[model samples]
Target chain A: DVKVTQSSRYLVKRTGEKVFLECVQDMDHENMFWYRQDPGLGLRLIYFSYDVKMKEKGDIPEGYSVSREKKERFSLILESASTNQTSMYLCASSLGSNTGELFFGEGSRLTVL
Target chain B: AQTVTQSQPEMSVQEAETVTLSCTYDTSESNYYLFWYKQPPSRQMILVIRQEAYKQQNATENRFSVNFQKAAKSFSLKISDSQLGDTAMYFCAFGPSYQKVTFGTGTKLQVIP
Candidate 1:
C-alpha cells in the first residue's frame, strides 16, 4: 500500500509564529500537493510541486508557501501564522501521469491562537 | 477556470439502503478525469472511484458506482448497501491532465441504523 505520512496529526501555534507542516510519500510520486480543508469552503489548494525544487501556487496561496527540496518530501510553511490560517491541512501525492490518482495523508489539523 | 459543485451539503440514509450524491462541474477541457473521494472521521481522504472523460461506461468499485453524464457535466456517486462505515464527507473532484484538481464543497453523509 502506498503511504503518505504527515508529520503532525494536530498542532497548536501562536499568532505571528512561523509554522511548518511536513509531508513525505513513499510512492516516489512526482506530484505533491498541500491543501487546506475548511467547513463549507471545501479543500482549497495552497501549493503543489511537480518535481524537486519546483513549486506552483494554487488558488489560495496568499498565506502559505511550499518547499520541495527532495523527491519524496514536500513541506508547507506559514511565515506568520494567523487565526484564519488554522485549518485541516492535507498532503497528497500522485504519479504525475494522465490518469494519476492522488494518494492523501491523514490530515494535520492546526489551531492558531 | 474549472469549477466543481456539490449541491447537497448533507444527506442521510438507512443502513443497507442506497444513496446518491450529486455533483456538477464546469469545464471546457474535453480530456479530463472525475473522482469521488471519501474523508472519514479519521480525516484520511481516500479515492473511492474515478472515471475518465473519454470513457462512456461509468466506473464502479464494490458498493460504489458513478453516474457520469458528459453532456450535463454531471458526475454523481451512488453507494449501495450503505453501511456504518459509509458515514463520511464525500467530495467530488475534477482534474484536467497536468492541472490541479478542483474539488467541490463536500457532502456529508450519515448512515442511520
Candidate 2:
C-alpha cells in the first residue's frame, strides 16, 4: 500500500519558535503539498512543490515556507510560530498533474502557546 | 484562479439513511478534475470519489457516490445507508491537469444512531 508519513503527529511550541514539519511519501509522487487545517476554515494551502527544489506559494503561504530536497521528502518550515499559526498541518502528495487523488499523511497537530 | 465552495458547514443523518453534501466550483479551464476527500477523526485523509471533467458519468465507491453536473459546475457527494463510521469531514477539490488544486471549506457530517 502507498503511504505518506509525517515526522510528528503532535507538537507543542512556544510563540516565536522555529518549527519544522517533515513529510515523506513512499509512493514516489512528484507533487507534494502543505496545508493548514482549521475549524470552520477547513484546509488552506500553504505551499506545494511540483519538483525537487521547486516550490510555489499557495493561498495562505505568508507565514510558511517549504523545501523539497528529494523527490519523496517535503518539509514545511514556520520561521516564527505564532499563536494564530497553531493548527492541524497536513501533508499530501499526488501522482500526476491532475488531482487524480491526493494521498495524505495522518496530519500533525501543532499547538503554539 | 480556481475556487471551490462547500456551503453546508455541518450536516447530520441517521444511520441507514442517506444524505448529500453540496459543492460548487468556479474555473475557466474546460478540462479539470473534481474530487471528494474524507477525513475521519484523527485518521488519515483519503479519497472517497473522483470525476474527470470530460466524463458524463459520476464516480462511485461502494456506498459513496458523486453527482457531477458539468454545465452548472456543481459536484455533490451522496452517502447511502449511512453508517457511524462515515462520520467525517468531507472536502471538495478542483483542479486542472497542470494546475494546483483548490479546496473548499469542507462539510462536517455526523451519522447519528
Candidate 3:
C-alpha cells in the first residue's frame, strides 16, 4: 500500500528551540505539501514543493520554512518555536495534473512550552 | 488563487438520517476538481469523494454523494443513512487541473444515536 510517513507523531519543545518535522512518501510523487491544522481556521497551507529543490510559500507561511532536497522527502522547519506555533502538522503528496488526490501522513502534533 | 468556503462550522444528525454540508469556491479555471475530505477524531485525513468539473453526473460512493452545480460554483456533500462512524470533520477543497489545492475552514459533523 502507498504511504506517507511522518517521523514524529508528537513532540514537545521549549519556546526557543528549533523543531523539525520530517515527511517521506513512497509514491515518488512530484508535489509535496505542508499544512498547519487549527481548530477554527481549518487547514492552512504553510508551504508546498512541486519538485525537488523547489518550494513555494502558502497563505500562512509566516514563522515557517520548508526543504525539499529530494523527491521523496519534505521537511518543515520551525527556526524558533513559539507557543502559537504549536499545532497539528500534516504532510501530503500528490501527482501533479487535474487529479490531485493527496495521500497524507498521520499528522505530527507539536506543543511548544 | 482559488478560495474555498464552508458555511457550516458544526452540524449534527440522528443516526439513519441524512445531512448535507455546503461548500462554495471562487475560481477562474475552466477545468478543476472538487473534493470532500473527512478527518476522524485522532486519525489521519482521507478523501471521501471527488467531482470533476467536466462531468455532468454527480459522483457517488455508497452512502456519500455530491451535488455539483458547475454554474453556481457550489459543491455540497450529502451523507445518507448517517452512522456513528460518520462523525468527523469534513473539509471542502478546490483544486485546479494543476498542482494546487485550497481547503476551507471545515465543518465538524456529529452523528448521534
Give a tens-digit lDDT track for model 1, residues B1-113. Answer: 99999999999999999999999999999999999999999869999999999999999999999999999999999999999999999999999975489999999999999
Clashes of each: 0, 0, 0
For every model shown, what is its TM-score relative to the native structure? 0.98, 0.95, 0.95
If chain B of candidate 3 is superposed on the true chain B, what is its TM-score?
Answer: 0.98
lDDT of each: 0.95, 0.91, 0.94
> Model 1 chain B: which ten-residue window has the lowest total lDDT?
B94-103
What DockQ values do the models have? 0.70, 0.64, 0.70
Positional deviation of A11 in candidate 3, in angstroms?
1.1
lDDT for residue A26 in candidate 2, whole number 0-100: 99
TM-score (0 to 1) of chain B for each candidate: 0.98, 0.97, 0.98
Evaluated on chain A only, model 3 obtains a TM-score of 0.98
Per-model C-alpha RMSD: 0.9, 1.3, 1.3
- For TM-score, the strongest prediction is 1
lDDT, candidate 2, A1-113, per-residue tens: 99999999999999999999999999889899998998877788899998999998999999888999999999999999999998999999987554568889999999999
- In terms of lDDT, the poorest run of 10 residues in model 1 chain A is A94-103
Across A1-113, the per-residue lDDT of candidate 1 in tens digits comes to 89999999999999999999999999989999999999999999999999999999999999888899999999999999999998999999999775858899999999999
1 or 2, greater by DockQ:
1
Which residue pairs of candidate 2 clash? none
User: Where does model 3 exceed 4 Å of error?
Assistant: none
